[model samples]
Target: MTTRHQLALGACTVTVAALTSTLLVTPDGATAATGPDRIHDIQGDHRISPYAGDSVADVPGIVTGVRTEGSAGFWMQDPRGDDSPATSEGVFVFTDAKPPVQPGDEVRVSGQVSEYVPGGADSGNQSVTQLTDPTVDVRSSDQPLPEARELNAGTVPETYAPQGDPAEDDSIDGLRLRPDRYALDRYESLEGMNVQVEDTRVVGPSSEYDDLWVTVRPDEHPTARGGTLYGSYASQNPGRLKVTSLAPSEEGFPAADVGDQLTGTTAGPLDYDQHGGYHLAARELGTLRDSGPSPERTRPQRDGELAVATYNVENLAPDDDATKYERLAQGVVRNLATPDILALEEVQDDSGAQDDGTVTSERTVGKLIDAISEAGGPRYEWRGIAPRDGQDGGQPGGNIRSGFLFNPERVSFTDRPGGDATTATEVVQRDGQATLSHSPGRITPNDPAWKDSRKPLAGEFRFRSEPVIVVANHFSSKGGDQPLHGSTQPPKRSSEKQRHQQARQVNAFVQDIQDVRRKADVVVLGDLNDFDFSATTSALTENDALRGAAATLPEEERYTYVFQGNSQVLDQTLVSPGVSRFDYDIVHTNAEYADQVSDHDPQVLRFRP
Candidate 1:
């Protein structure tokens, strides 16, 4: 599976300077003011700190939490604060190492006020206000910690963020925070403060990175399986919060799945990171109560039904663990019910990610076929053209490509010569039927749209003596897109431009086949890496050439992927008008589970062609 980027918490040495009551020196060698007497004064009513870049001395607070790992620091909150809800009373002291303090120790800190932007400034993320290069003086120990502000459904706002100023490139940095109106502003207003949520539901499954996502408001765009549905760009769910433990690794983070509930209060400092923006670094972790949500299985295809399915077995290789291969095989056999034709994406080369000159996936596909047979499925045959070395834009040297697996007992793959990696396939008329000139060929392999990306593989199949054209695609990923909680409003999706071009090319290919024979039965399926309601899907289904099967389901059940607490649709199956009578299902065997074989849920479309 493709693991997303995370915040790298590195260690730094904390320098202890001699304690002095005199005014401190700033980075510009200027004498700084010593009186920002309260934490609320330092953290003004805006996102950026009012006293940034100046050194302040003797800022007193009670240590709310002590983080001993990853840029070791402590969070302190002033008990006595001005009666302004817009300004927070807590601040983080970046000591660069383990500070000599406990959770309840009252102390005075001297440091330079700075705005450290998570993921750097170019990432367009919001800056976190911090006190860096500190000199700490422990006044007393065992004092009471500040009361954590409770964050619940009623406390969080319905709107996600404020409309950014267009003159400043739609940036929300300079705007005054309105904690009552918008969610982002509320999170910013409580930025390094101690916060808590009671009886929260886990909307996103626990990832491998020892973190999980929970929602303060459970009813926001809820899925049937207890996940927040990210239906549209306008309804970005505002109550989602990522949770990571401040306890040691031996304490064990919860292995939570969707529908699991954090029974008690999960309290921590509200911190910002590069991965998911505002998250709670939990000091007082909650207990997990599993709601017993299991994986879902789709109904098997009936007689006279041609079932086609698509699964992105994330970066599958030959040398992977046998348990992974077995689980995947079981998902295909037991959960998917052995579809007549399965389109597999991310089938890596035989060497996996090793940077050799190898460009074949025989061992990879052969191992999966053996596993399926071992798991009581048919001995399916496979067909795919390998891409040139280092051309595809997956992990380097993986040579990830799409392939088709068909059951010979139910369907036959029509094999034709001259189908290779760089050869573009054409639609031809044969015996008053539309067929591919080269079966298992690529769709415009040399086109600039497919540059450094997986080319769509097209193959012909004969089921019940009827020819069906299938196109398997793994489009460009959304690696470079801006995040939802980023500084820019509406978030720039620059990666969609390439997917749009790819969709247009594939749509034109389907149109060409229809031109050859107007009633051709064509099925296009795979990980399109775009949403069903997005422009990419629109371009692929334009002019009524194809219809997105995902759109046929209810709005709440339309997702096949879960990303950052939002259930969405990234895998899709679109069919031509000739195959109008069909039953479609997105099998929820994965994506919602913490122990998943693949990151995406497989989608199946059964029809009589």
Candidate 2:
């Protein structure tokens, strides 16, 4: 249950690049006193700075942007206008020695007007009024680019969190940022200034430094393939930002995907970073076009019925990635129409993450059943239990477990024995019905709410003749929780009591098989990282013995994953009551379409037994 868009780049790519400045301006025609004390009087009206620690000198404005890489610096801006929408006529002139300045020039600078706060001063970060060691004087050089600040369309700010009060663990929300109802307080009322955004679409996907995440108002949360539908939080669509990229060696940035737009008018400056929060460091880039058709769905076949998918294949093993095991067997045969009975979460093993333990994934389930019989589907026949080699955590030699894949010509696998792997799958009652003697086994796996976690497994098929079973799960992750917007407020989900006691011990082993057989057709699905409006899914559907198949869609299509833009539901499936209704959907293929294969967005269900 850990698919938080797994691209894994721990950090270091927030650069919006253009910071060059060797302080040059000292030419003799000198001038040092401008007047209305400009650069928005050291960017005040709040957010630190009444001249910070003062050393003030001449302050004028007009450089507009430079950044010769890493933390170099330049960004001025004072064409005029002080009606103060919480003052911010842009600043940042901290220099290094002295020499080359361009973009509109007109300078002045001086030194020591600090207020910096980048990663210091108690580090909750976000301060930057800068001017340190500065020198500059230029007073003139092609002064044109200034009327920029355009964020258009309905003036943004529909709240993305900040109902005030709540702050601490990693922090946020000590309130007072109402810069007009949120969008991170209207980007902290023009923090660091100089902005733009026009027609910027692209909803996240070109990373490894080409950075992305646009939407300069592509009609806010519009879904159905046009991108941007992460809903809830009072429609906070301050017209998406985060674009970062420093001319990646000139002309090499176009792998975009979602609703793709980025062609012109992106401007830049507004920074406030800790890795993607109010970013726009984009000095100028547009032209991506291709508004895609790849948000595809429709493939949950119904004829000759038997579907059941679950896919958290984000970590499949067998020497891993061979084109993501042929693009997850073309999303399990052209997008899940081949789910005879899948489940397969994380998988791994056969030397994948190299933890030296070598727990089996049977060549990672024989390269996804030989790439789902070379993508024409059906050859399946798999089963799992593994663990004990690494107590079931994940990615350390890739021992990830939870599995079962079927289509033995449409179900059968009774396996009847105790399928080991450190044991647990009970609820016997042989002739009284119920089942699971060890079909695929591993449930309580030496309890302690199943230690390092991933122990659910079960399986015991038979389909049409009735008696299904399933289970699968890959729980225990909210990876250290506490985030739904910080400073704690309502955050602190510190792994919701170990996923609410692993959903009450998988609801007491599914109430010990519907109290020893009572129409037992169960399911339970994968990646239950919690949410279906969580409480760890009300301890797995509390009084109802199991339910959520995304509570049956609608409520704006009950999500499958999305993060940052919300469409929340950490992959579900549940079922059980009358055991019938399992015709589920969510095959939106890969969490919000990136250059995808799996960050999990798969889920089929379908039933006709």
Candidate 3:
């Protein structure tokens, strides 16, 4: 990945105007469909096999009935003579997560057509597919999709509600709707192939959710089920398809309305009961859109070469920590020396667990990008958040997270373990509870929270097609003291061992990465909070899985963190044997200035393999 740094920060902002009703042909020169162009008419007895790329003409409907309450989805009915038709007496499912309209409300909706088989033995009845957008025509009595579906069985609790209320008589509350599904008729499919699909819908809460759906497709369908067809978008949403119908076209599938189109397929939620068991499936995908063009930049000086740096932004408080900690004003002091990738420790998130409040990590990265541009460095983007939740024991505050700051212009995220870019990295770096013992004594594991003590954060990214795994860490520090057995004070060994255990965890993580991606071009860099010669460093370096950057440093210049009259190489940069020959070496190898900014110095290594 490429990184840049500029010393100036700009407040300039740009927003694109919304698209008008006139259809602007997409870049591929195709007319965009509106609500009216997509809905189709169907008879009750039609057997809706669910075509992923199927389309229907738009039609006006009234809230005929709703199935369940608390869970929002609906059933619709065509108004008779358009005079505020009464809500239907029969029940149905409304597909949109957002409630469309109340009973008596008149609206035009476009979605695929499907038949509802009321009773067990395939009672053939046809129904209008789910509404995918709110921009559809809504007259006085008409509204957009109404009510959000919280869950079918209640594992996830609903958090927010639609902007307005449905008609008092609207009964389309709990009609269990199947997210339309699709099946690609081919194997080894690429982007633009004409594929066939059945009963699949495309929808997600956010762009990130959609991106995760795209990337995790392969892993979700690792096997063939009864020789059924395989395709992408199968594993995007798990568990429920409260999602509605699919609109297929010779062009491709339609998804969330961005100014631009993203080509993906539609698929129904996995059929739990009919399929006998819940199995991952994929279908209803459409042709591809140009993957958004990569942001352009002057390629870094040497295309294949990488400049790697690691920083320990000591106690970097999140935005909500305190006004004084709102350090966006500082520019990119720590990461000013831009490299293709910057591994940082003590990075705080902008929001706490459950979007509780402002976590500083996002803001920190934003400021870093600003600083990079100001310093005249290449523009960079970031990916992945460390899996840290600041809610330590109901402390009620957002927690700082560790993570990677990458230049999207230079690299793109390829693989993210577990496809969870929202949470901290669990498989790579961990923050678990740990007991404290300052001296050489073992922690008694007394407190329940000890097992969940501070853990390191780690993630990986690709730089110029080369894997660069950055690990940001904040190990157990010697702060809180635990009382000794029947004694008023804890021996120093107790805390030391606690920190030692933290180091051991770091050591094992490095070993584990090597064990899997054996040839991984790994950079185990972070704020270790222990000296170069300390037990922590020893634990990591002794594993043969890691070699410290200090080994590549000149004598008298390896220290990165300094204390009052006490200088130690607490912060270190390390490389694995995979990239050992990259000619790597550290910059800012000494921590001479740790007073104002942080407790450690920022280190960089420039090398070419």
- The lDDT leader among the candidates is 1
What clash pairs does model 1 have?
none
Positional deviation of 374 in candidate 2, in angstroms? Answer: 3.9
Please give, for residues 298-372, the per-residue lDDT of candidate 2 as tens digits: 565566567887888888778765798898888888877788888888887888788897887777788779887
lDDT of each: 0.89, 0.70, 0.39
For residues 1-609, write the lDDT of model 1, one tens digit per residue: 222232222322222333455677666787866968788999999988989987788788898888887768999999887888889989999977677678888877778789998888888788889998776766677997788999988889999999998998888888998999999999988888889999999988899988899999988999888899998889899999999988845757778898899889899889988889999989888889998468988899999999999999999998899998999999999999999999999999999999998999999999999999999999999999999998888989899999999999999999988999899999998899998889999999999999899999999999999999999999999988888998888788999999999999999999999998778899999999998889999999989899999878988888989888899999999999889789999988889888898999998999998
- State the displacement of the C-alpha of residue 161, model 3, in Å, after optimal TM-score superposition: 67
Of the two candidates 1 and 2, the one with more favorable TM-score, higher being better, is 1
Candidate 2 lDDT score at position 448: 80
* lDDT digits (tens) for residues 1-609 of candidate 3: 112221211211111222234442333566554323312223211112233223333344544333233334444444232221111111233343435445545544444433332223321111222432223334455443222111221221121111111342211212221122211100101101111232222211112112212211222222111001112111212222212222234543333311112244433222111211121222233343432222111212366677666666654543434332333223233333456677666655554334555544667567656656655666777654433354322223535445666667766555433432233233332223111111111112222322444344455556665555556565555443321110111112344566666666666656666666666666777666566666667777666878877766544445554322122456677777777565433333223321134545566665553
Which wins on TM-score, candidate 2 or candidate 3? Answer: 3
Candidate 2 C-alpha error for residue 164, in Å: 4.4
TM-score of model 3 vs. true structure? 0.40
